[model samples]
Target: MTERKYAIYDSETSGPRPRYDQIFQLAGILTDDSFAQVDQLNIRARRLPYVLPGPKALEVTNIDPYSLDSPEHYSPYEFAVEVHETFQRWAPAVFLGYNSIDFDEEIVRQMFWSNLLHPYITNTKGSMRADLLIMMRAYSACQPGAFVIPKNDEGKDSFRLEHIAPANGFENMQAHDALGDIYATAFMAKVCQQASPELWEHLLKLCQPRGCDEILSAPTCKLVTHFGVSETHLVTRLASNPTNPKQVCVFDLSVDPTPYLNLSARQIAERMRTDFRILRTVKTNSQPVLFHEGDKLAPEVTAEVTSGESNARLMAINDHPTFKIRVAEALSIRASEFEAAPHLEAKIYDGFPSRDDERLMREFHEAASWPQRKDIVARLQDSRMKQLGVRILMSEAPQVFDPAYRDKVKRGMLENRLMPPAEADLPWETFASARAGLAQVDDPELRARIETWLDEQEAAAQAVLAA
Candidate 1:
């Protein structure tokens, strides 16, 4: 069998929201199966034209706003394309990073989706993803002595890459820097693998979609979850969503299963809402830490419930014929509560593009001229693709449009950035909100730079509106 490589990566973004914000710096190191570095990449990009950089994000990253506009940096689209291509070139590898599955991964998907590229490249095409932060949480819970898990000022365990990495002997970790964080993550991975080889191997397997399914298939299992702090739960798989098999609904064994066994689908759904703790939704693809019956568990967790009682509860839940069906119904009901997002970026999960639209997306990227790209966008079958394609043209190739239409697009973009709808809740940072954020910035120099940038943006918006 061929040994798989690890594509460890990190990204520094303009803000927290993946849909609204943008990745400014993306860096990664490709390593052999043994964690020996084979190749590396670091790319920086200017923010998208319509994106308003959050002041607090700028403060934490210590990135100068003006520096993003430097000629050497790639444009947002270019950066996205480069990153996408690089990851594609390093295919069939495990895409690992610190806290990446939650934040950086979303940013990558959004960047690709917004840029007319395939969004699921990392998890598809023989590739999978792993998160060091999640791994660390599991390691600390399951094998506490493997590495030093640092505590925060509040006495809680600090799983922040910067804190945990240094504590585990990654001495030169640069916290907010993308490339530095990748190195620190790689170091931590090596440490975990060295200290507890068996557990490390098991945790790494959990990166794949089917990794946890076998363990979850059993009558009873132990799950280590982190919500501020690590907590172990005796869990039994109730049902996997028919629509999305990755979403497995598990019943907490500590909670009495007898009351739920005979409940109707509607009643189970009601119980799910009233007592939220009864059911825990675990995305198997997201690297959940799970242990089987014979696996050694932490003493604290083992002491919480006797093995005999937990196994009996699991057997009871498993043996009930209609239990899984009702749980599946409840899962579907709970999922239906979230309304469809109106924004194009947030509509990414609406559905997969048609074959014709997918072909056009590739053509749209390959088209030499802006007019050709615009024409291709017009031919797109999906409305979401067409809309996103137009936005791309407006940002990258507005010259292709008629003078009046170009100006209209520019004005609309400016207005969206400066004057969003009063009643609508928007995720993007706006000029008003960015200006408001200025009061929180303590550094006078940074504040002045941000203020000046905001002033320039306002003046520009006003000019476009006047036109």
Candidate 2:
């Protein structure tokens, strides 16, 4: 079967910015290799103490305030811990979402970052990540009418769950709600796969990170990857040195790089910095679809896009003794420059302790009782681990921690700026622009509804200030 085990999930957040927003709801369903549901989770968390809810987001999701304020809801820390434990069971399965690679996945990473859990869990332990929207787009471009394509307000095709679900005959009245979206996404995946198995298989293969290593190491390649709604076919050769395996460097064979080859390494690097098309290098682990010199492509792919001549020329350039060495050297120089900027380094793994410290963390996470977990965290040697531990203790079992320690952890979090900063001038700043935009709206009902929403929001804000 083309279908593989996947855990479809979705998140409803306070706003769009992952770094600044907070996710209040998380819903996931674990499916078998055939995409059959094995387990599920639908958790609503208490609002993060740090973030003010985005009014526009709140209005759209229409989450019940009573449910949010109820004692039954999971605190942010509790939710994080529960999600971590739940995912551990579903792990090593491809993490699937509608358009999660760009949004929901990042929110998961930030949640883990704040909670001191492994942020890159989706990619860790032989697992993979896939997006239904990407495959849907690819299918729409290559094999139109395989599934339903909903039109937007402009009568153009839209991949949004709000439109796609109903168009495809899937119930999605609760569109923005987390669990509702997950069910719709899972059903969409199943429908697409069942309708066109071969295309579905090909797209799923593209999402996996496994095959890229072999493809990137090859002498010549026909790389087929989706950019926007269309796929681009490029004949590329490896350009980076062996030292930089993580960084993929390639020369585009369709366009000649020989003229640029005459330039000095620094000169080539400068041009590359400005125009990426001059020399293309994407990370190998990003799962680009590669077909070496003689490998067959999909039947739907046209010859003009994947011609034999282009592949042969790519082979010639790679085989040229001097070409490989020179490009590798140039890439090494450019990489060194990027490495110098320390702040640019990723902080996703910041809280993850060393291998030795993993044992303590594991014990803390696995302990049956909250007191046992607290004791384990208190005994930890690492400062970061201890800080995380005490904070978790204060959050999970506040009664155990004395008032002094609880206050200290809260103060430390603020002093260190661990909390996400609020966008003080928010909807008002966007509201003015939106009103100006509404001038273009011809639909009287739609315009009236938008204006009403804005007025209601303003009233709510005024009432809060008055209170």
Candidate 3:
């Protein structure tokens, strides 16, 4: 018989965001840590405002708001009940997901919070949440082919998830739909299991580790409340680090930054077990900078702090942008660019007593501003919709093309087996070119030209018929 295996999970969404504006679909899955299938559950429910389905969503999920009957529509709470009941049967002690913490768990929590009249999150709070993506990330760090970019001759990686499966010897299955996502997560788990059998076995031993139900204590609840339902790599970094300071290695955990610090020199000393001194409190526009009034920064991570005999080290790194691990020894050697300089980068190196700062270090506090990066992952995810829009419009011009460009219009029409677009139909052009023309063209002149052209084309065709 298959080994006693399981994982419980689902995705929640107001929509696929970019792809579909239809009912937000939240899906869940249960599987063995190794991703041997056990059970699957999807919550196709939405409590969303009126927004048209994005071309991408319409293409991928093919959601139709007009088709379903009112009774057929599922509520958020109703979907959760379905998930809860399914879990009750398989009851995998552990919860598993891809990027459920930020995207999935966030939507799940909000759904329960809003829909269920007296909603109490049963699997929430200290629930045994695991991201296969994290396993993939850690595995990627140790193994090969973790990225999915297609770089030019520069020898850089331009890998995305669509290419990930093929790079690692798995097929890229139909994506965006619930089952397809489940299959991909399962595939990733399978890959991780194969790559690290020993670790996989260890994880299986604790499939639903003893602290599986820690939501009893409120911090576990924070896991869902914070709804870090982002991708796997981000979530794992959040895990394995506690929000307190200790004189441990900097590699033990990442430190976060905050508005003000509260740890005193003594408290800081106690945590680091090193002598603490006041750092220069150089204030700044964004965050307050504190230079080391003490000997140096954390010695375990950086070598500069270790050798500095003068306690005049700067307190920085709390708000370092990328959460990278820096060598303190390099700080003393590398002058201006390092933390001690007068510029914004240097001032950020100043120190702060750990507390809220430690908390910030432990979790990702800031979000990407305004427009998010349009990564290949997003583009590939929306591939279906992009194809749909391009195909449809490409099939029939929204307006007729120029009569002089009849061959161009005829080629497209024949290819799609559509009635050939007339000479007056809107002609195809690059999206940018079309937008520019629409922006500046004199509207009345454009209309007159189009009408005149249509009449001439019709008359010409009639003359030919008469001949």
Candidate 4:
């Protein structure tokens, strides 16, 4: 059997929105097949030129702006190069991170896109990605009482890393720090694996692309998976798609589709306009694991999916052949429409480029030094490709170029509208929203401190306006 290498990583970012936010700190802990520690990476990258750090995010991560400009820190371009190389070394390994699918993965994808590297590099090249948060939830369901459940200030069960880490015997000091979180996540994975080897093995298998395809393509009556914290172990059924098995639609079997089935096609369309979860689709490649109909599940897990009336409704729907066919048809139509309209952001972050573009990008990424890359890029005739090359070169190693070259690169970026325009009002709009959220803070002292920070930010903005 091949060695089962794994890379557990974490990133602390500038803000919540991945589109504009940039990662300032990133850390990873690599382990061999047996979960033995092998190598690690911890880096703090300088903030991107156009990105603004969120005040609350900065406070939580304790990322100082002045320190980000220090010699120790890597520029965004340099950081991208280093990260790409690090993952290449650990290529074909499972990329696992806590709540990474929703947040950290987006940050990484955007970083790669902006830096002209493969955005989904972690998932391609025989590699795969998984979210530890989902695994943890699965473990909790599969092996209840295996790990301690910690409550927060409200006395509600909290699954956040800081609380869960100490509960599972992992040191969690500097809880919000990227390196600390990486260590904690790795240790927690070990603990979960030790406690429930079977479930852990299942999760690991699900992390593989081939494994996901097999499981999703299998015959399933009713399956169980999670949507969010509140909707854990949601029962679903597969809706057929002849071509792309990867784009498998899983209907929420627990939801009563019987009421909607009685409606005409027009009424069903209207209902879809309101709430589309009459059926749900699972992109198996992205989210692989789902408990089969007859799989032995813990009582708590069963309770979550097999609810009282919902279970009965699903059984009824299953029994009615006509109902099942109609519901499937409706879901299939919706899935077809969704597939036709690909997300714009996805195009921007696609890992696979054209053969020619890939070859050039690979060459640029593999180039030994900045000057070598500049030389190769300067020879490119394609304006877009040239712009990408110059952008990466300028950002990654600005010190290598003289003032004139730098000016030309900046002008190119401006002409292409790659950089945010000086007069853009989005930042001010964000500031207003942040200020509104600050009013909800009940802690007088903390609120006062946040207000002071906000004032400084406003002054800085005013200075930019004056400039």
Q: List, in order, the clash count of every candidate structure.
A: 0, 0, 57, 0
Q: On residues 1-467, what C-alpha lDDT tens digit does candidate 2 reach at each position?
A: 34457889999886676755678899999998667789999998886533445445555676543355457889888899789878878888889998787788888877876676777778788678888887777667656788888778888778888788888888645788888998888888888888788767766666654566566566655555555445445546556555666567676666655666566677767766876753777665454555555654332333353456665666567556676666677787787785432221134434456776677777876788888988887777777667656766766686777777666665544323322234333322233444555565565665666566656544654453354
Ranking by lDDT: 1, 2, 4, 3
Of the two candidates 2 and 3, the one with more favorable lDDT, higher being better, is 2
Candidate 2, residue 88: Cα displacement in angstroms equals: 2.1
TM-score, cand. 2:
0.76
Candidate 2 backbone collisions, by pair? none
TM-score order, best first, reads: 1, 4, 2, 3
Highest TM-score model number: 1
lDDT of each: 0.85, 0.68, 0.35, 0.67
Candidate of highest lDDT: 1
- C-alpha lDDT (0 to 100) for residue 344 of candidate 3: 20
> Per-candidate TM vs. native?
0.95, 0.76, 0.41, 0.77
**lDDT per residue, candidate 3, 322-433, as tens digits?**
2222222222222322244332211222333144423321221121421121121123222322232222222223233344454443444333221223333322221122
lDDT of 4 by residue, 70-176 (tens): 67789888898788779878888889899888788777877777666777777888888888888888776667787887989888778899998888777635688
What is the RMSD, in Å, between candidate 2 and the native fold over all Cα?
Answer: 6.0
